[model samples]
Target: MNLFTDIRTLVIASLDAMVADGALPDGLDFANVAVEPPRDAAHGDMATNAAMVLAKPAKQKPRDIAEKLAEKLAMDDRITSAEVAGPGFLNLRLAPGIWQDVIGSVLAAGTDFGRSDVGQGKKVNVEYVSANPTGPLHVGHTRGAVFGDALASLLDFAGFNVTREYYINDGGAQVDVLARSVYLRYLEAHGQEVAFEDGTYPGDYLIAVGEDLKTRVGDAYVGQPESVWLEKIRDYATEAMMDLIRADLASLGVVMDKFYSEKSLYGTGRIEAALDSLESKGLIYEGVLEPPKGKKPEDWEPREQTLFKSTEHGDDVDRPVKKSDGAWTYFAPDIAYHYDKVTRGYDLLIDIFGADHGGYVKRMKAAVSALSDGTVPLDIKLTQLVKLFKNGEPFKMSKRAGTFVTLRDVVDQVGPDVTRFVMLTRKNDAPLDFDFDKVLEQSKDNPVFYVQYANARVCSALRKATEVGLDVSDAATAAADLSLITDPAQLSVAKKLAEWPRLIEIAARTNEPHRVAFYLYELASDLHGLYHLGKDNADLRFIDEGNSAATQAKMALARAVSVVISAGLGILGVTPVEEMR
Candidate 1:
């Protein structure tokens, strides 16, 4: 059903025929030959660089090879004409029946129209939104969460065995701060006044956790020192905050396949084992790290520390794993954590980190590389910040979350669908300005609304067809005589639909979910254009009073648009609206 792929196959077949006739050199690698849409739609349906790519390798001029290739390709029934454009680019015009058949294929496939098998079911691990278990998730975490979830879904749809994971940051000093903060709230629950000092969390969200602790075990640690209660309260507080984090993710319709606790790696053999694996590979050693050339060095002498030879694995320099004091550095657990992932035998690993973690990318990749002996590849995608606005004004931060807008706050205002869609409207590495006033508006400027409106319009067409006593079921529409859908406007939308499977493969190969959003918006624009054309021309309308076959053909095309829209929205984790409000 991929017209581009089918056309590329024809192009390759014609090139083989040229080689068979001695018109082109044999053994020329044509793997780089590509058939894609022309830069300008007015040029042709597809443009291929086969001649341009093969010219130098075949020791022939591009124009000469292009002329012969065009002649060979014009023999196919599917390709109406092939013309040589500037220095050997071949632009191809497809037969009208091909576009008509694309609509039929979409109807037959339904919501699974664009699903791809490009991933080949390879095992992939995607870890994202590993926010600290100290409080609610904020705006930046929401972007990563939405991006990560969509990416996992995209890979799954692309035939990858994807596992969605969240790493809990409960092993750090921040959790200690959370524990003490909860102790303060616990004391307040005992009818005693306690002030939140400089290191304690003062958010109102923790008030309930403290009250819950009071309800669980009252009067047990009221007057005790830090020794007897610290560990107990730390575990208790970590669990409570994880519950809060899980709830926040649930509100956004994001579900994780695994929640890996950083604390579980602590005092466990996992850290020692990961370091042991490196040591066995001669990657671990005791050394001193030098500072950058331009930066002023610290007023201290070199000290022996356990380090990993990350420089050999593409990092800028070797990194420390253990300090002089014999304590594991922050990098130690991270190495061990990723080693655990590698040991589980994943073909690929992807981390969705905030833009602030850009420095961690190279070192983390080096760790995974050294851990897997350069077999498993790791990709770290950093999501940029989100600046929230409403009515041309900056949105205020939530007092409950202290400094930034919480994920719950954004989801509650706009709902999960709008929040997820707007979050992906930009590239993951670029800053996004999410305007509440603009996103919720019913105008075409709101991409989410526009895409949803296209689906609703299709449903409206289906309802009208059914009202006229025509069978609007999927089976009926798929079997409709599609040659009746010969209008240029209707065929234009079908051409766009034909690009869906190709776009899915492109998005999956690049590991970019935002491309799906961009493609859906473009497809919706084409659908809207065709629907508007039906308004002025009665013959272009989906329903015809006398001919059920013609009406079914037109309605079939409309439903195919909705089918692709639903598939795209499914990957985005956004609910498709059958009727826009």
Candidate 2:
């Protein structure tokens, strides 16, 4: 079904034949040989660097090898012509039937057309949006949530066993602040006026938790000491905040398979166990790290503490696992958490962090590497800031003004589909400007609407064909004589369709979900272009009005495009529109 993979197989087989004919050396490495679309579509449908990669290795000139390879490739039925372009690049023009088959294959496969097995079922743990469970998720957390969810879906489509995870930072100082904030709210619930000091959370979202606490305990700890109420309120408040956070994630269509509590690593021997594993490898030591370069904290001085030899594994400096006060540093719990993931037998680990955590990247990777002994790899993706725009003007977020945008605020405004798609339009490391006016605009510039419009138009075509008594059922399209689709415009769509399987592998390998967004935009463009062309050419229309065979052929293409759009949107977690409202 993957025409590119099939064509590459033929190319490799021809190269083997060349080896047999003594035109190339025996047992030459072919891993670098690649079959990809040429930069210019007019140059060819596909091109290979086999000749260029093998030329110097085989002790032959590139053109000399390309000429011999061309002679061998011309014998294949799929490749109509193989021309040696500049610097021995072999550009191939595939037979038109190859493009024809791509359409039929798409129709046959339905929405499952581009699902790939390149991952071979390796277990991948993608941890994202691990924001502190202290308050409602803000706009900053929304970007990480969308990126991680899309990445998990993309990896799943590429055949990786994906586990969507959220690491709850409940064991941090922020949760204590949350506890005190809720306590103040609780006092207010008891008819006491309270002031939200500089350190306390002033958002109205905590009022409910405070009232619920009053209902549960009914004045039991009304004027007690900190010891009596702090622990109970901290636990209750943390759970409530987590419940609210989960709902916020649910609003965006994100569901995590795991929610790891940072508190769990505190009471148990988990931190010690992770450190012991590192100690056994001589990566743990009692040492003092030099103060950071340039502007060191004035209070910072040489202090021997529990340190991880992260420098050996490529960190800028050896990092402390324990503070001078003997408590575990924040890095300690993180190291143990990733160690637990490695021990759970995942083949790979991916962490989606906010851009501010860029400084934590190297040491985190070093810790995971030391824990796993480099057996498992960790890829940390840092999601940059999302700037909001309203009416083409920069939108402001003010915590003191109590006008901070929550994830719920965004989903309520645009709905989850538009939220997810627009969030992914930019690369994770690149800053994104999410303009409210532009996203809802029903134009090509609005990718979410444009892609959805393509799906809606396909549905319109099918409904019209049905009205004209054409057999446009899934069963009929699957059984249609797809060979009748011979127009150059029709085949151009199928050629774009052929790139899906390859696109999935590339996007997954690069951990870049923006590629999927870009690809869907291109596919939607092709579908819309083909639909607009039918306005002038009656033969290109999906509903022929008289000839059932021609109508089936056109509907087959339209249906195929809709199927691919649905599949791509599924990866993006967007529901395809059946009709535009």
Q: Model 2: per-residue lDDT, tens digit, 382-470?
A: 99998888987887664432557789877877999999999999999999998888999999989999999999999998998898788
Count of backbone clashes, every candidate in sequence: 0, 0
Measured with C-alpha atoms, the lDDT of residue 392 in candidate 2 is 74
- TM-score for each candidate, following the candidate numbering: 0.98, 0.98
**Cα lDDT, model 1, residue 522:** 96
User: Quick one: how many clashes does candidate 1 have?
Assistant: 0
lDDT of 1 by residue, 1-581 (tens): 67888889999999999999999988999999999989999999999999999999999999999999999999999889999999899999999999999998887788888787789989999999999999999999999999999999999998899999999987888888899999999999999999988778888998999999999998899999999899999999999999999999999999999999999998879999999999999999999877656866777568899999999899998999999999999999999999999999899999999999999999999999999999999999999999999879999999998777999999989999999999999999999999988999998999999999999989988988898898878888989999998888888888999999999888998999999999999999998887777789988877887888888898889889999999999999999988866
Number of the top lDDT candidate: 1
Residue 437: error of model 1 in Å?
Answer: 1.1
User: Each candidate's lDDT (Cα)?
Assistant: 0.92, 0.90
Model 1 alpha-carbon drift over 4 Å, by segment: 297-301
